[model samples]
Target: MIAEICFTADWLERKRTELGGVDPALLERALHAFALLGHLAESDLEFVFKGGTSLLLHVPVIRRLSIDIDILCAAPAEVLDRSTDGKNRCGQSRPACQVASD
Candidate 1:
């Protein structure tokens, strides 16, 4: 069974002491969001998450945080389509359309 770590003041302080750089509040938020994302993508078979947030969360020594979630879907771009189940989650292995900053 997976044990859930609760966020208390002591835990936040521990993160602050260990990282010694990022704000504790930010760490809490990022970790919380990341954990949620991990759960969201748990059964997903399409996208492979990548980029800075992935790096920071997956790497034990990386204490920095990013403000975005980047993903690279393994399915071919041809399958891109939104789900019709009234949920925003992708369907048919669709690529989430995004306009890059470039």
Candidate 2:
């Protein structure tokens, strides 16, 4: 599962890089999103790092222009459901999710 998340993140980063010169705001937003994802994965999905986001956390320079953030999860379905369903572990609906889904 960890491998799966890492692969997914890596793929997304590659996609971002392919669309070269993405704006700083957009990059920051993406990184923030990844941080949220990491939190969710850690809290609800019980994910542990397998040297995934460590790269981003340790290297400040890499954080600036990182194509994407990498994360490892043991439960992909839980992550997907939480992400799609817009509910955190506490069962709170994320307004952003509702708006985006709508």
Candidate 3:
């Protein structure tokens, strides 16, 4: 189930209490993870969640600890005024489209 991120100090403290007896480090990590995932879920960009974060949720009895999140995203191609590709340092033809999200 998708969970909403809460910003209020009371809600945050309550959430910590609900999680119950968690190490401060683990609780901080979990809160950060949920907050980030909630933010991304609220965004318009299309994405595929991957890597350690995925394993943390999907795998059972895994030994390694996850400390990071990874995602792959795609956006519609668009033309731009400048080129950022190093190989296209000197444009032979027209400048390639640039993604402003960078």
Candidate 4:
């Protein structure tokens, strides 16, 4: 099951200790990246998560935190438009996902 990202002081403290005094802002950015990733996963889009952030999270040898997410969307850009359900958790219209040009 995919977990939702919730911000709390206790979460911050735990991360700070776990990551050896990494900046709180960077951690927050990471949280946002995770949230976005979770949203993407819940959608119908097909993607492969990769890059520095992926390594930092999954590879124990990488001790540094990355502030961004890098994903390769396997589906066509038009599929992204059809997949979004409009309203998000915040009741705002969800923005269309953009696939980076190679």
TM-score of every prediction relative to native: 0.56, 0.40, 0.45, 0.70
Say which candidate scores most in lDDT.
4
Tens-place lDDT digits, model 4, residues 40-73: 7777667888988887666755477776678887
Candidate 3, position 101, lDDT: 45
lDDT of 2 at 84: 42
Clashing pairs in 2: none
Writing each residue's lDDT as its tens digit, candidate 1 over 1-102 gives 112444567767877787876787787766655654554474444566777788875686865776556666545433333321224442222322232231
Model 2 misplaced stretches (Cα beyond 4 Å): 1-22, 50-53, 60-64, 76-79, 89-102
- Candidate 3, superposed: residue stretches over 4 Å from native: 1-23, 60-64, 76-102
In model 1, the clashing pairs are none
Residue range 1-102, candidate 3, lDDT tens digits: 223345445666775666564454665565556455544554454667787767867766534445455766664443222222333421222222233343
lDDT score for residue 33 of model 1: 51
Task: Specify the poorest-scoring 10-residue window by lDDT in model 3.
Answer: 89-98
- Give the higher-lDDT candidate: 2 or 4: 4
User: Best by TM-score, which number?
Assistant: 4
Model 2, position 31, has a per-residue lDDT of 54
Candidate 1 regions with alpha-carbon error over 4 angstroms: 1-3, 57-60, 74-102
List per-prediction Cα lDDT, in the order shown: 0.54, 0.47, 0.49, 0.65
